[model samples]
Target: MSRNTTTHDEFSDRTILVTGSSRGIGAATAKELAERGGDVVVNYRTSEDRAEAVVDSITDAGGEAIAVQADVRDPDAVDELVATAESAFGTIDVLVNNANISFSRTPFLEHPWDEFRDKLVGEIRAAYNCTQAVTPGMLEHEYGRIVYVSSEATRTVRPGFSSHVVAKSALNGLARSVATELASEGVVANVISPGPVRTEASADVLEQFEDQLIAETPMGDLAEPRDVARTVALFASDDASFVTGTRTPVNGGLLVE
Candidate 1:
């Protein structure tokens, strides 16, 4: 048993692979996991340089990490990503489906087919491919955690984020179904919906409404990436073994029903 029952000792001896970890929520989540003693495989699509910086930060902090490049949109690339992580860390015990291209400012009418393709299809493919890739190892160990980084957009229906809302909503449904399918095998899948987190990607999207958002949120400010990452860290732990097939809202009372 780990000195911290916050999760389990399996995490100490385990590796977690986080997609799109070069920045934003992904980077924050990877750091949080590493801080908790998990070896981290930081996956990035383009920012190998940024990825290395994140890895260096983790190492500097006495955590183990490596940067792995994979365009999550490509199935073959995701397969290679799984192989690389397993090779580097011996096994992948957790998968954080955090790679996403933001569509916050693109309204439904203004959304181009290409932009929609880039956001929805890319995320869906990434989640499906990566989950499939990491499952065998998880099953062999009879334990795994898959946290899909979703958004509060599904609940609030942010007008300009139609594409993102649709895509993230699909992820919720995908998680529920997969959770049911995998629950018997000791694999858990869930979603963490963070309301308006303040990260490089969100700073641009929330610029105009930042003040209004703060006023509306009960927490009186936008969520930080670490807020959501901490939730991911919890879900990735055995502490949440009984939790699955549900969305864990990390929002600051923005869309509470």
Candidate 2:
């Protein structure tokens, strides 16, 4: 699990748009796709410098990439983002919905109703906006891949994540629906639910629960961002042409069912 070692060139002529890809799993997936010869659009709501850095890294590695800023929750902005990517790369062949708000670790009883509604609406809206914007291009080409970044928490419940899990569960359902409706058109949709992954945002949580997490995980280790990214690359590649309406977990064998 080193970074950027994937040799799949299926995306050589494809363009991919990854939301919230300035850092974390999104960044890793963007780089992995670029390394595999896909032109990448790195989307971020803020963190312009970080997003630009990701673009620079891809270009330095001889891969094509550009950073675009758009709030995925806004339909108009998402349309603009897709338009920009299409303008730069001709057409977008893959859409990775990875942007999400961090969950607040509060007791279920103490969680505000408005906050929960906001979280659910925001997450679902972003996915809807991106999916709607990218489907027409995919339909025209008769080839597309939609990958939603979900969470294992939906299956393996944890305290203080009720709203987050609910939203992700809905997203999984959305992906499945997209798969059913678009499969005949040569477009595939799938979900990747990662376990506890080591990233900048999860550093503190990992540090606090490293022992507990490893003990629960049969693999005895946490997943790196690249671990999740590799799976995404597979789904986005032509190799997974028949693999649609599936949810693959990348959670180190934790909560196996």
Candidate 3:
């Protein structure tokens, strides 16, 4: 493959996988890394067109990228997804565990049992599945970067976001543990905790509460998907080689951590 036509070729030899990248932060991250010269694998559970569009955006810009379909919550599917990407480019050196997770805003008692269980189990399972699938090769190569996309809600839980808080809160611990365990082996792990982002999925919520959110944030604005993407790329790049086990917030100053 030709080297990515960007200013820096640091990622020209790297292969990255960003799950749930059909849109939002994941899509922006995939594009960001590709632009930095990495061959990127865009993973999505559904939304083929959106995923392909992400790939196209990269390739059109003279970067290498491909879209793969996989439900990261399933180990088998993750295995297949990693294998396919590896076959196409090479072993994945950077795994951005940005799998899509949702908040079912209901009081704990009112939350449906199945939805609660699914959201909780599904989030952790997806990260676990992808991590297990790619880390073996990363170990063999002696280099890896794992970034988890978490939420600022974990810090100060919202009234109706018990499940979301629980799930996201787990990621902070998981990332730290992974970093402690793998840092010696040349693998670095970190978390990006973003606040209410202005994306299609959150448009309704933002439409109703954007004014209040902006007022509360010192930055007086919401985070764009690309804002979180840039921070994720930093963790994935050599720039943050010494930055591990951190839950860096990309919330436009909404929360000071």
Candidate 4:
């Protein structure tokens, strides 16, 4: 993707931290926020090259960015990540919890309990750690945006995604609770649940249901990472100050309410 120059300025002089931003939706979000005038910290667990590429893209576009390495699942690492961002750009005004593990589909009955437990713990714990690390800084500044990238599987009730759905559902609940507790303090929390985004992580699953998904979706196409990133940008901007505790679906009408 080419560098986007659309400027919103809502994030001017602000700083953003996007976990797992080395690729896909997270990468797209990091670029989008940077384009809109936010200095960004690109956090990646294992993709240093990709993370630096993201930073280079933003900087090449006259935006400020830095690549930081952190495994979001580790509390100590998360704390260090937040500290690194603070040291680089003062404070993180937006936190996007987009890092997650990709696992092969398995029937709930046949799936190993250990695998299920690991998936849930990994997904939920990462978000918990990142949130805990950033909240204190946000509270001190009296301004913040917390966005959790979720999935439609939580509500669509699809098979073969038992562990994924449960973990995302828990993330939604966590966002809501955080929103309620932080709304009065100028910090807003929300979830952006995208249905079947086209990414390496979802390629296998999308291949299995491409025809059905396209037919069911009113828009007749799967979402690109940029599609979800746009919604995330909205939530991360100052324009969404009053919007909290809500899950905005970027599913192209696949499961509209």
**CA-lDDT, candidates in order:** 0.87, 0.92, 0.89, 0.91
Order of candidate numbers by TM-score, starting with the best: 2, 4, 3, 1
TM-score computed on alpha carbons, candidate 3: 0.95
Q: Give the least accurate 10-residue stretch of model 4, judged by summed lDDT.
A: 1-10
Clashing pairs in 1: none
Leading candidate by lDDT: 2
- Residues 7-83 of candidate 1 have per-residue lDDT tens digits of 23446887899999999999988888988889999999889999999999999988899999999889899889889
For candidate 4, the per-residue lDDT at 74 reads: 93
- Across 139-252, the per-residue lDDT of candidate 4 in tens digits comes to 999999999999988889877889999889999999999999999999999999999889987787778888999999898888899888889999998789999999999988
Quote the lDDT for 213 in model 4: 90
Model 3 C-alpha lDDT per residue in residues 182-213, reported as the tens digit of each score: 99999999999999898898898788889999
Clashing pairs in 3: none
Task: Identify the runs in model 2 with alpha carbons over 4 angstroms from their true place.
Answer: 1-5
Per-residue lDDT tens digits for candidate 2, residues 89-203, read 9778999999987668778999999889888999999999999999999999999999999999898787888899899999999999999999999999999999999999889
Off by over 4 Å in 1: 1-10
Alpha-carbon error at 24 in model 4, in Å? 0.5
